[model samples]
Target chain A: MTAAEERAVIDRVRRGETEAFEALVLDNQKKVYNLALKMTGNENDALDISQEVFIKAYTGLHNFRAESRFSVWLYRMTYNICVDFIRKKQRTPVSSLTYTDDDGEYMDLEIPDTRYEPAVEAEKRELREALSRGIDELPQHHREIIVMREMTGMSYEEIATTLGISEGTVKSRLSRARQNLVSLLNSYGTFSKSGRHKTGKEVEGHG
Target chain B: MADCKKYMDMISCYADGELPEQEQKLLLAHLDGCASCRALLSAYRSIAEAAEETLVQVPDGFAAGVMEKIRKLPRRRSGGWKAVRPVIISFAAAAACLALVFTVSPQRFDFGRNKAKMSARVEAPDMADTAERGTDSVLMDSAVPEAGSGEFGGTEAAKSDEESLFLYEAAGASADVETPQTGMATATDSPAPNGAATDGQPVDSTSQVTRHPGVKLGIAGVDENTLVIYYAVFTFEGALPDHVTGVEKTDRGGGLYSLVVTADVARELINEGYTNYVIGNEDAETALVYYTED
Candidate 1:
């Protein structure tokens, strides 16, 4: 939806037209979810944060001020929530020990890849996994900036606004973040033969 | 024969189209002569391209799940107090405990002060010289050329709009000049132009510098990241100065405006006058105009 349409829906929701919020949620959920996923590096946390963002936006609708784009405001909330979540997680270390099921059998926790499909080609999966690992290795702040700029396509200005920083800071941080990611990817040997072959195949497939 | 290190620092800006025309041409020329820089640029480009091409799909029912939670939220007027109460209580309790402890053992407070004094005593000699040099640099950096005073000696007050724009743009470009990552902590620690006294200890020299009249946003104690975030919020809120020049919108629809103010306006805001006015609050009609240390 256009900004005007989004504003209208927000106005409706403010006026107790509760269903109107669904429009805003539907329009933004994918981007919000992706942002959370990128930051948290897990589907479950991403989903949780995405839901929390919409809920917080709904409840805190009055403070939004409409000074910035809705997406920028929403992303700011998402960024803060994710940062807090990460910090909280850091403070409390989780046990790696598996939980026993009702059958009294220990079950290995599996990382569910909801996006996985049998038809997905090998090269694409390898590249995605490599990129994901590279991204996961970054400091939380750097990762957030990269996801905001590169994945979400936020301009340096929007990012500065959302993250509450100057454009210069945004540029410097993003440049450093990218450099770090490149280094991480290099360490993974992704710049080598198999990776290069996959990349060529991936390019050819796109072409 | 431009320095490779300098050009390397600028490659990202060049790639982002953030470099001015002259700098862009200069970087392009350097790229032709330097093979290593070319490879670095290629690496950066590949990373950027891969990032752009890779798409992360949202899970099914993501919106529905969000909507379901939204429906469950109590349609209350304001939940701000409820959300903040726990934090407020925790802080209050901590403060009360500290007060109780201080009341019982007043000598403890003196011990703390003594400890601070001892540390300050150790650092005093070194800090004094650093402060003096810092002030000199601040003056040198902010000295604008006087109008009709040839090319080299007046404050920004003497410069015309075009001159102001040119100087400000040049400053902005150089402001992004990369330093070693380890340099950032020390860089931020350099004395603020206002020479804000730390721990209530007065720095007499701070008073010698002329204070420009007008609204001054004190940035002495705030951390760099917080300052940047506040500036962004101010931009979104549209709280910046009125006369801004050289407005350029980024590819993602945020504005970069050069905040040009005469010397007489205010000394603090003019410290790093230019702003990247990313987004403005539609209702508030204000832009973020917080200054960063040049």
Candidate 2:
């Protein structure tokens, strides 16, 4: 629904036409579910997050600012809930910065050969699966930025606002996330011409 | 090649069409010479394409279920928690003596599994105070609109004074929490050791766990995973702020548990970016505080 439509239904619900809230739920559930699903990587947890988000938005409707788009506000809520759930589930630090540990070994960024890249659109299904697995392998912060931008199509500004970070941080983190995914898929070597036992660059040649 | 790092960062923005006009020109010019960055951009686009197709079907009747729960919400008059909290605090202070009586007996109450059924009283003097608090709580409860016809206000209408006082905040967590009154604790698996239930142990057993529904609903808007924090001193930094009125060190070597405070204190912890602490075991008037050092 448009922000206006959302506002209208919200007014109706506030006016005691409680059923009108369902329209808001239906309008936002799919993307919200997709965002949640990608973040948690669990169907049940995703559903739990999505359902809870709407229930919260309805109950806390009064706190929503008039100038804000409900979708942005909704996605922000989704990100926060998933982050808390993630923090609770895995009691590890969800940091995005590059750091060296006590052992003096680099722990954050690892460089993979960009030359051995998968050919895009050559084998869509297999490439898709490779990407999915690659996403799962990413660090928690990387997974969040990737899902927010590439998967859920949130703009950098939106992601920055949603995550309470600067837009520059959003861009940098997203860059790292994509690089890590490419590195992962490169190791998979699904359509990499240089990969052993693969000669052709597949049908979709590199530009 | 050294400049490629800067251009590489721009490629992500470029793919999303978020790159500025000048930076876009610079990136495009750089891309002509940098095959690696070009490959990276292609990979980013391909990832987006695949993600666009990757979706989990919304479980059937999702909307209907949400509405079914929403329709059951209690009607609100001129207020919500904001309207009711102050009254509860003033009265809960009058009942403040119960805070001692409440904390002293831990196993007597089970905050989870709906196992809190402590009927035994301290004595007649405290009983008079307890009875007074109970009446004040009922008066506090009257500020909220009466619950809708359903499973609520059923067997709960006759719960003992302690149960009623403690359960009031759970009931206040959200509207949905009020209805499924019977099985609110249906999801909890680990019972958090009722033996030393009153001792605040800072444990982080993050294995897949569930909590009573009201606690979940209560922190849904702010922070959902808060109640999992086991203690204060281990996870919270610095000395307890002066606002932390009572700081009785436990026998567990400087460990502290069971903070009773007002609402703004809870908001302060949340706003200060302290993820480890959260409010719990609250009535309309007072709250149980858990702040973490980590």
Best-fitting candidate, measured by DockQ? 2
TM-score against truth, every candidate:
0.49, 0.55
Kept native contacts, fraction for each prediction? 0.22, 0.31
TM-score for candidate 1, please give it. Answer: 0.49
Off by over 4 Å in 1: A91-125, A192-207, B52-55, B76-294
For candidate 1 chain B, the 10 contiguous residues with the lowest summed lDDT are: B212-221
TM-score of chain A of each: 0.71, 0.74
* Candidate 1, B51-92: lDDT as tens digits: 755657777777777767656543334422122100001111
Interface RMSD of 1: 12.8
The candidate 2 chain A region of ten consecutive residues with least summed lDDT is: A198-207
lDDT of 2 at A89: 85
Q: Which stretches of candidate 2 lie over 4 Å from their true place?
A: A91-122, A191-207, B77-294
Q: Which docking category, incorrect, acceptable, medium or high, applies to candidate 2?
A: acceptable
C-alpha displacement of A32 in model 2, angstroms?
A: 1.7
